[model samples]
Target: MKKQFLTLAILSTPLVANADNEAVGTPLTAPPEIAAVFAGSAGTARTAEAYDVSPAELDRAIATFTNGMPGDSAQWAVALKKSFTAFEANHPHTFGAALGAFLFNNYLVYHDLPLDDAADAGMKSVIAQYDRLVREHPEDYAAADKEKYINMIMAGSYAAMVLHGHHQDKSLAGQYAFLKSAAGSALENYFKVPVDRVVLENGQLIAR
Candidate 1:
């Protein structure tokens, strides 16, 4: 009877992960210089060095964002994406891409929070952040390389999402494997630049 119960428990398991836990996989915690770079973007949440924008202003912007959204998961995802796009572009860096990825995953999480194996949500979060980096930072990354990175991550995410919808995949480990390999390739291409070109001997950042 115990053996039969165990088998039933295993078979009854749902999606193994959920969207709320999905993150860009880039440590959100950043150094001050990088924080400054992040603070320069428009739609980004306040970083360590973020400018003193009033909370009232932020609340107003958020209200504007959710006011017209349709009540659906996919639509909420679209709304979040659009919200990220519309935020003030004060920050010069695309670090928020990572945060946006997290939020996007959370949006997915809201729909499938009850599922036990929503690993696709986590995978999409990482992919979203990677896409943000590739889309926003072209100078540090070659256009061809950037395109390659976006394609790889997006493809992985879509594939994972499909598997989740099918309910056939018992584990989503393969998606993460693909992301890591793709990220390594992207890193290699991104670092093919002269160190001096991206940094100054004076300890300043490289400019576009």
Candidate 2:
């Protein structure tokens, strides 16, 4: 059954649980107007899928999308590290590829993982790459767009991290608290104010 489930999960249409479905997880809800901006930008290989991905790469991407920094925080961070390294090796900018790397790698910051030198370097590289893209193509990525994408991903990732942390060990109250605080920051930063209420659609914020 375990093997069957794994294969099915991999082969299926990404197995994404709706954000509003508490059975899968509690996603961060943001103001409708603000949430709409973020729903368009989160996720690893899905939202930004222009690059050619191998079967193994596809598997990893599926894991990250469905798992969302659960027990696999360390593994997730490591995979993202390797992705960034390969992107750097390419020399030429594949905008979608770089953007995907940046979006996915940034989620690692919220995961409870100890990033080694390589992983740390990878994180820095993605940040640099994202910044360069923004700078070089302000017309494509305006300041508001950059802020929206970053905050939207942050809100969603931190919310998932908080849920996972609590589920893994109820005793780790401190960690969960920290994650909630981080989620709050992401919400406020993106909305430009603390949102009192939010609406979600398909795990993305629809209305506040």
Candidate 3:
């Protein structure tokens, strides 16, 4: 009976981790230096320094998601959302790119099989939800939010694909080439800028 119960429990366990299933924990804090860089108050050198810390902070969040106690992942998600929300309030013009960078770096971290699989799955889930939202309540899907949703989906899906290539030991040049192309395409589509005018500098995409 014990063996049967154990088998049943194991079988019932989910193969993929869901961020929603996790409880919210401590809020993730964004360092002031990062905010300074986003605000254009910091120098180019400081920009590099601040961005260097950003990845580490994101990794800390990922660590909490994967290894910390139950609800830690959800906590980190909520915390990051809040942190970015506050940052966005202050740096309205640059916040979208900054958020894209956060998603890019966060998705780049390599995780074990199912969790890594979840990265792509999560993007698909976003697409499905957005589709459902638009289908069921067209009025609620405002034009501005529509663009925002599309941008987010692109950033997330691109990052997930890049991470997948990284995990497979794909060529570094190929990965970056794809990223640059994606960035250029996004700028062209959303901002109506010529792709040639877009440049990647210090990990940020800038449109001239």
Candidate 4:
């Protein structure tokens, strides 16, 4: 009986994973620099020497971002681009911070947020961010690995949209499937072990 129960538990595990993805996905906690970068975007740009925003304002912004569900993907995409751009411009020395911010924001919009708009800009940003990373820093292994993960998320979401009959255009579904397959193949080639799932808690992308 114990062995039979163990088999049932093993069989039930996939269901729980799927449920976790849809309901309460994984939460990504960022480091201090990345969190500061996000806060700077919402509050004020930090100086070369230090972050110089009003503590109250920054705190409030952080609360709103961390507490609220993203309303629109395109809007979040634009905000992310703006924030990352600002971070890079202000703190060129802390290059990795910008990347961290990008990854966090992208995951939020790409997966956790609702897909209300079909405009290409949101998806395009995902591709563009990765492209920029590889173009600017080809030798960085982290950038390459991140690109694979981004592609996987894109492909998986698109495939889900089609598989669950969410698309109005079958042709578009086919296109997304192709993109998904391409991303999957690239990810398999690039990373020995890739991230199998991505989950974000509400307001997880926004940081204080």
TM-score, per-candidate, Cα-based: 0.23, 0.31, 0.25, 0.23
What lDDT score belongs to each candidate, Candidate 1 first? Answer: 0.30, 0.36, 0.31, 0.29
lDDT of 2: 0.36
Residue-wise C-alpha lDDT for candidate 4, range 91-186, written one tens digit per residue: 322222222233333343233233334322333343334334433443332222222222222223323333233244555565444434433332
Candidate 3 off by > 4 Å:
1-158, 161-164, 171-181, 200-206
Residue ranges of candidate 2 with Cα displaced over 4 Å = 1-162, 201-204
Distance (Å) between predicted and true CA of 67, model 2? 22
Query: Tens-digit lDDT track for model 2 on 1-208?
Result: 0000000000101111233421111235545644554445543322222234454654554354445555666665554434433444542333322332323232332343333455445444544444443344433332223333333333333333344445566786776566545544443333233433322233233224
54: Cα error in model 4, Å: 32
Q: Write the per-residue lDDT of candidate 3 for residues 1-208, one digit (tens) a residue.
A: 0000000000000011113311111122223532222222222211111122244554444453335434455654554444433333332222223333332233223121223443334423432332332244322222222223222322343344444444565575565455545444433442234645434334333345
Best by lDDT: 2
Pairs of residues clashing in candidate 2: 19-203, 31-207, 31-208, 32-206, 32-207, 32-208
By TM-score, the best candidate is 2
